[model samples]
Target chain A: EAEVAQSPRYKITEKSQAVAFWCDPISGHATLYWYRQILGQGPELLVQFQDESVVDDSQLPKDRFSAERLKGVDSTLKIQPAELGDSAMYLCASSSNQQGPYGYTFGSGTRLTVV
Target chain B: AQRVTQPEKLLSVFKGAPVELKCNYSYSGSPELFWYVQYSRQRLQLLLRHISRESIKGFTADLNKGETSFHLKKPFAQEEDSAMYYCALSSFGNTPLVFGKGTRLSVIA
Candidate 1:
């Protein structure tokens, strides 16, 4: 099965450091998403991208977090001055349609830990 | 605001027993409901969706509009069924999904 690829399966950084995660969505998928999943919580949307444009980022902490999907394919998410509270599993997902039977396909995720 | 509520943090059931994971949602617009599962050491994946109305891995969920509920059900649970299940909701168009905290199902032998 085609899978969404993510890098740096696990990362640990000191507080206030910068961290970046990469994601390569399944081929032909147009919509990509970034989500943060805390220890005991479900994944929460951080941003959504349609092709190369950001569709929604209302929940993203713009002061420290940023995401970009250039060329409407692979994408990257970055956090500067990462805080302890920012430690979580960052998951990337992609889907072909706004709504469909397949729904979203998720990556294995990058587990972040801030010391 | 679009929100999903999964009341139980965890549920334990014996093998061969019926299983049910409750989910409720609050959405102003027409909603699309989905159930996503994450197995140990595996990536999260789509288990089923209300629109498809199909049973996946012997599991099925029916969307209830009047009660605003979409509960996952299985007649007989298996050890392999143990995993974390999340209930998600989405509005029309390219809107992002709003997920409930999730329920960890532990099917005991």
Candidate 2:
């Protein structure tokens, strides 16, 4: 079974530093999403990309957060000048537009801690 | 905006005991619900969806539109069922999956 791939399983950074997380969605999937999950809470959508174009980013903090899917196959999420509150697990998920029984496949996520 | 809620943060049950994980949603239009599970040292994966109505690993959930709940139930809990289960709802196919806080189920041997 194909799965979403994410890099940097763990990261430790100081406040005000820039951090980036990468994700390669399942092949041929038309939709990809980036979510932030605080401990004990559900994953919150940060951004959504539809075949390289951003579809929804209302919740994304544009001042410090930016995401790109130049090729649509892989996407990258970046946070500049990170704050302590920005520390959380960043998850990537993908799904086909076909509306199959199986909805979305999520990655293990990148655990980030900022001091 | 679509939202999912999993009220139970932790649930403990003995082996062979019945178990239920509660989930409720807030959505306007017809909604799609799903349950995803993550075991220790493993990736989050799909467990089952309400549309299929098929029981995976003897676990089943029925979507109740009147109550706005989709609770997962298992007749016999197993130790392997110990994992973080998340309930999700997708209101629009063009949007992302909205997830709940998740329930941690521990089946004691």
Candidate topping TM-score: 1
Name the 10 consecutive residues with the lowest summed lDDT in model 1 chain B.
B89-98
Best by DockQ: 1
Q: Residues B2-109, candidate 2: write the lDDT tens digits.
A: 789898999999999999999999998999899989999898888998989999999999999999999999999999999999998877555677889999999999
Q: Candidate 1's residue-wise lDDT over A2-97, tens digit each?
A: 999999999999999999999999999999999999999999999999899998899999999999998999999999989999999999999997
lDDT of 2 at B4: 90
Model 2 chain B poorest ten-residue lDDT run: B89-98
Per-model fnat list: 0.70, 0.75
> What is the lDDT, from 0 to 100, of the residue B9 in candidate 1?
98
Q: With candidate 2 superimposed using the best TM-score fit, by how many Å does residue A111's alpha carbon deviate from the native?
A: 0.7
Candidate models: Cα lDDT each: 0.94, 0.91
Each prediction's TM-score against the native?
0.97, 0.96
**In Å, what is the interface RMSD of model 1?**
2.1
Once fitted onto the true fold, the runs of candidate 2 whose alpha carbons sit more than 4 angstroms away are none
Output DockQ, candidate 2.
Answer: 0.66
Candidate 2 CAPRI grade: medium
